[model samples]
Target: MIDTADEFESACRILAAASGPVAVDVERASGFRYSARAYLVQVSRRDAGVFLFDPPAIGDMQALQRAIGDEEWVFHAASQDLPSLRELDLVPPRIFDTELSARLLGWPKVGLGAVVERTLGIVLKKEHSAADWSTRPMPQSWLEYAALDVEHLLDVRDLIADELAETGKLEWALEEFADELVRLPKPAPAEPWRKLNGLNKIRGRRNLAIARAFWLSRDALARELDAAPGRLVPDRSLVAAVVAQPRSKGELSSLKEFTGRQSRTQIDRWWQAFVDGRATEDLPAERVPSDALPPVRAWSGRRPEADERIKAAKPAVEAHAEFLSIPTENLLTPDHLRRVAWQPPEPLTEDAIGEALASHGARPWQIAQTAPIIRSAFVHAAQASDDTDESAS
Candidate 1:
């Protein structure tokens, strides 16, 4: 294990001399800190054994960056680690996400442990899953866990690459990797109040207005306390509080509805704000429209002919996916399948269908095999729907 800056630099020099790909894995301090930062990074090369780099000790990763920056770096679930890597100003030119690659290749389990076991015939221990990676002077077991992550990644990649080539799906994997490199992490928006479970049932504009105010107040307090919004004040408590409309601290306290930190820290302030806000508001309570909710469809209750078509198409799609060594979901999502079953687009020539499939990220080989069947099934569904509509009219 490489711990100090000098050792890390020396390892980078050795890795830089290699022409093949390098396996990369990162361990971050996620739960311990509000921001995700890499505490440790493990790398493995074809000739070189595993090496772990301590980000804090190294101070700067310029040498390590230069080594792996140009080569195709393989990672499992790259998105989670990409943000922390970007923070250090390290930009990789070529990237391959083994998880995405496995999913694309129809592997049921895409996790690193599972992939390693299945593809490389190695069973990785899971003792370090919940360990504190931020702790200094890393434990022996943790180091082993970290080492195992990248140790078999290169071998796994080789096996998957062969499968991709045999199935004529190598281009799909390349396209996915290219797409992965351009993605960046985005901050989640502050909309805690909007996620209330059943707030829509409360009658009137006034209820919604008060609920909105309460939600904003709760959010502000949560942020101030550095606590999760639900931890600060649950939606149920807020909804109940709004319904009761407590006029004072005593009334709010008497309700016995809230306990813990929210009651002790925020109830009095929240009640006062609600009372003060209500005095100026004159809007009547309004009922939220039921139609605004997402429509629920019963898959089994659909028209028999449509159901038959969908059922018939499933095995064919699965077979094609298996033959291509890619997941069936990657070819088309369930939602897309439903759309094709219920409402399909107009007929197109084979070439146009192939182009459309390719544009949607399907490999050339996949398009060549599945496009004709998909297009025909969709056209038939559309015509049938049109006929039914005309007859009803």
Candidate 2:
């Protein structure tokens, strides 16, 4: 509950004096704001005690960073928090994600709250789950909730780590964490905006071009305003606005869907941008071509047989998964099953099939359990298809 910068620095110093791994949690206003930045950071060390950092109050995070930089910190789901921590230039040398550890050890549910409760026999209060962390003069309840999140994280990590070691899955957990480190966020393609609601009805390429222009304009405005992008211009309104092709501010404002600040401040520039965008003639075609389906050769034409086999095998797979208290998808993907159902059975050896599964990231134990069923399905399909071809000849 300490709000002063000096108190925060002293707390961080106390944490740095700890001998073992630290546990961390972050509260961010992502959907509530234009920028997905951490508004609060909470950390707890083995001996020093729990600390909740108000990111706005302590603008510089150098002290906190230097303290935890070399320590083996444990986070429930590191990937989500790592990015936000990176934004603050606080990079930990080593990280163990408890959720990923649980998944690697074949836990049924890997959610933070679930893992923590299951591992430590403690229930977390979710009262502050949706609280806006960016607000100044933070509520006492929110501070308590934030502290509680990291308080038990070290205990959960120790329990999960011991479980992983006893189960001989420590290497597996390490591999999973290594894989997570490389999966840092990358920007995605922008074309999928066409499939957004109402935009699909705007048939021509010109209208789509106008929509793209307007969408980009709104994106920039949202960034500047530090508001959610949708608040600046909703997807449906953008579509409707473009479709109307309003040439003047009055006409733009007259559209039933356009209202509030968008109708006032946004109308003129948006209209101009759309009009300018429409003037350009070489916009890409709005509609995805009908001939875009993969070629017949690319499709495993044994889809019907594959479907039947998978449907028949699903119950057994589910039963096995339930018996083991794990998800069926973790054992074998539907694509793997379908591929096995449609392939030739020249390589009848289980080792060969196991190797194939390994290539697709299946664990050795998973391949060992599911290889027999997969091989049998392949043999059955191969025999059936061969008989049909022989009859035709």
Candidate 3:
């Protein structure tokens, strides 16, 4: 591991002189840690070999960033690693996401191992993928596993690039990568605790408040200790406690359903949170208003015309994606299709549909191909609705 300042700088210097795009991957303790931090960062470059760095042991990453910052970085699933990499100021100027490339190419399997096996004919041992990455002095086998992540990534990127170029979709991949590079972080939901497991089993605003309180208390404790909330107290246990409505710490501990590594030890804390939730008047509503669209199944009865629009347009867009030899979601997101179907703009010309598609985060290549299909399908949907109404009358 490149822990000392001199060893780190030496690795950076080697990477600086290495030719071609830098292949990079980050190992994070996703389920085991509260914070999504880069426990270990792996980078491989041609001629320079691969370097493994202990992110926590390193003081700053600016030196390493300068070494290869301007070069295009390659990753199998870039988005999953980019956030943690950014936390260390190791930003990339451009990226080549092999997973996204495979998706655009309409490959059946896009996982790193699958892509590697399919593209390079090498199978990667993935037993250590879910291992705790934050362990100090990581096991030798684990280090090798981390190193393997980026070992053949650049080769996969090259092979995929050639195939994409041959298919006339290289530009599409670049545009997709650019958009992903600048994608903004999603805003945190207002009522995150509302998504608790078995939440529907608990009814009434008071009970909901208790659930929310328990979730919030658990979240605070988890964050403070840097432990995954689920590790400390599983969602099922938290929800069960609310349903049981334990009045005291002893009662809470006595319930078998209310159990976890920390549940019994932190009984007083949980009890207090429950008491506060019971006394507080700030109860959550049963249903919240949102801009989210109704399910497509419900649209058939609630909005017949809109239902026809999605039914006709969705399959049409999907068929076009097939014609282009690309995945439907890769061509355009389903949410965007649903949004346009639910509420199309005035003067729904091809240009208007294209604009709508762009507004919903569709790339130019996607809008160019799908806008006409959507406009024509919408026109047919309206005409079909009119015909049905006339026959009924």
Candidate 4:
């Protein structure tokens, strides 16, 4: 609730004086707002207390940055919060992601509420987890809930750290956490409109263009009003409008399926999108180019050699993972293994396989474990093929 400049300064000073890594959490109005902007940011330190910050009220967060910028920050799922946190200039020097830590340590439940209750025996009411944080005159109950998020975080972190050390996964967890800190934001998809639900259900290039127009128009309006696009017009309504082929704004407004709070009220806008979509020279293509490989299950009929390599290697790799007491996917991502098997680099030694895995963003620890297994699998598959051919001849 520290909104004023004076209160912010006081809060920063208090945080600066506090000891240990800062526990941080962000509350974003994901479904209710247009942007993933942080409605509230909560920070906790050892000696100091929990502080709830209103980002819209406090425009400049560099002061908070200066206060705790040098200290390591702790978050449950740091990746999910980093984008919103960066928007406020609240980047951390280092971060310990409890979620990643739990994953590495093979903990069954990694959610903040579960982690706290499991480790510290505190049952937090999670009713407000999905509440619209953009609401004004913050409820007292919400404030208490927000405070509790960071309340036992540091304690839980300490407990988890000990468990990680006991299981010989502390270094692995640290490596994962460090990687999580520097994870680049995924690039925005080229034709984000193509992601709309039931988009494929509508066919023809003209219809595709109409859908594109609808998405763009809706996006612009949503950005302007700072409201979630779905709130103005849901995806189903847009698809319906395109399918109906409304003759005029009147027809568009009258379409029963084209229903939203602003659907009829903004009839002119919706109608224009349809008109432009029909007349424009830029019709959307049916399919976009992709570099993604076929699913692993399809490798058998597509590439028998790759199928052989994966079949020989995957079970062995999985067995090792079980021996190590880690998830198979965590040890080496299934896709990374499949890609390497499909098109393995020539001179496929352990080192060569390791390099190929590295090119696909595998961590050093993962490459170290799986490269030998992969090399052996490929060689074994090749030798088995030679033996079968010899027997036939």
Q: Give the candidates in order of lDDT, highest first.
A: 3, 4, 2, 1
Per-candidate TM-scores read 0.71, 0.78, 0.97, 0.95
Please, what are the lDDT tens digits per residue for candidate 4 over residues 1-393?
A: 878888999999999998799999999998889999999999999999999999899899999999999999999999999999999988999998888787777667878888888889999889899899999989999999999999889999999999999998888878788888887988999899998888988999999999999999999999998999999999999999999998888889998999887898888899999999999999878888888987778988999888888899999899988887788888888889988988998998999999999998888888988999889989999999889889999
How do the residues 1-393 of candidate 2 rate in per-residue lDDT, one tens digit apiece?
556789878987888788799999889976567887889999999889898887767788888988878888889888889888888988887789998777666777787778877987787878878776887778888898899889999888888889888977676567567656666575654564554567766877787788777777777787887877776667777787787878676888788887545646767777777776788776857555542333324455636555444544556666776665556775566555545444423466678877776665666667777877666655565577778889999
Worst 10 residues of 3 by lDDT: 242-251
lDDT of 2: 0.74
Off by over 4 Å in 1: 1-11, 17-19, 29-32, 54-60, 131-140, 184-326, 335-347, 350-370, 383-393
Q: What are the per-residue Cα lDDT tens digits for candidate 1 across 107-209?
A: 7898888998888788888778766678888888899899988998889888988887786667877876776688554446354455676686556667766
TM-score of 4: 0.95
Identify the candidate with maximal TM-score. 3
Model 3 misplaced regions, further than 4 Å = none
Could you tell which candidate, 1 or 2, scores higher by TM-score? 2
Instruction: Judge candidate 3 at residue 194 and give its lDDT.
Output: 84
Candidate 3 clashes: the total is 0
Candidate lDDT scores, in order, read 0.72, 0.74, 0.92, 0.90
Instruction: Report how far off residue 205 is in candidate 1 (Å).
Output: 5.1
Q: How many residue pairs collide in each prediction?
A: 7, 0, 0, 0
Model 4 has an lDDT value of: 0.90
